[model samples]
Target: MGSLLSVFSGLFGSKERRILILGLDGAGKTTILYRLQVSEVVTTIP
Candidate 1:
């Protein structure tokens, strides 16, 4: 519930790698989330 960038960086920095993707209906939330998940997973694997 704060700066998403800060949270993301913190998680990434700590190797926690938690992700939260959210958006309202008709906002392409699911699609974006799916892509983001794939990207994150890909990036995280080295």
Candidate 2:
């Protein structure tokens, strides 16, 4: 929600932010996103 967005905004010092995650196939990109969302690690299958 608003608070979560604010945390990210504060980290990057911006009111608006765009993020892109680039990696090879099966390189755990989904895993990284999952970690960010939940603040924990989980297995991801491409």
Candidate 3:
């Protein structure tokens, strides 16, 4: 976890990677979050 955090921190100024999907209130923010956590993506802000 610490190393992962460092990787995110290291991307401080690099080009960002973003994926945006829109849906209603009960859509699936939780599901997306779960996938991201499991995938160990370095950073995501939204």
Candidate 4:
């Protein structure tokens, strides 16, 4: 229905945001991404 379409649009109408993460090798970039994907707390050292 039109109302259902409007509600779905309202829920999903937000603009997309892009993020760029840059770091050198062994800088825990992958570790940080993994933690973010899993919603975990990560303790990392350089």
Best by lDDT: 2
Candidate 2 structure lDDT: 0.84
Report lDDT (CA) for all predictions.
0.60, 0.84, 0.70, 0.82
lDDT of 2 at 43: 79
Write the candidate numbers in order of decreasing lDDT: 2, 4, 3, 1
Q: In model 4, how large is the Cα lDDT of residue 26? A: 87
TM-score, per-candidate, Cα-based: 0.33, 0.54, 0.35, 0.47
lDDT of 3 by residue, 8-44 (tens): 8888856777877788865667567767769643344
Tens-place lDDT per residue, model 4, 1-46, is 9999999998789878567999998878878787878888676665
Residues 1-46, candidate 2: write the lDDT tens digits: 9999988878888466668999899888888888888999997654
For candidate 1, write residues 1-46 as lDDT tens digits.
5798888888678565556767675666566665766764221221
Model 2 TM-score is 0.54
Give the number of colliding residue pairs in candidate 4: 0
Instruction: Give each prediction's root-mean-square deviation over alpha carbons.
Output: 11.3, 7.8, 11.6, 5.7
Clash pairs, candidate 4, are: none
**What TM-score does candidate 1 get on C-alpha atoms?**
0.33
Q: Candidate 1 vs. truth: CA RMSD? A: 11.3
The lowest-lDDT stretch of 10 consecutive residues in candidate 1 is 37-46
**Can you tell me which runs of candidate 3 are displaced by over 4 Å?**
1-15, 39-46
- In candidate 1, which residue ranges exceed 4 Å CA deviation? 1-12, 15-22, 40-46
Pairs of residues at least 3 apart in sequence or in different chains that clash in candidate 1: none
- Whose TM-score is higher: candidate 1's or candidate 2's? 2
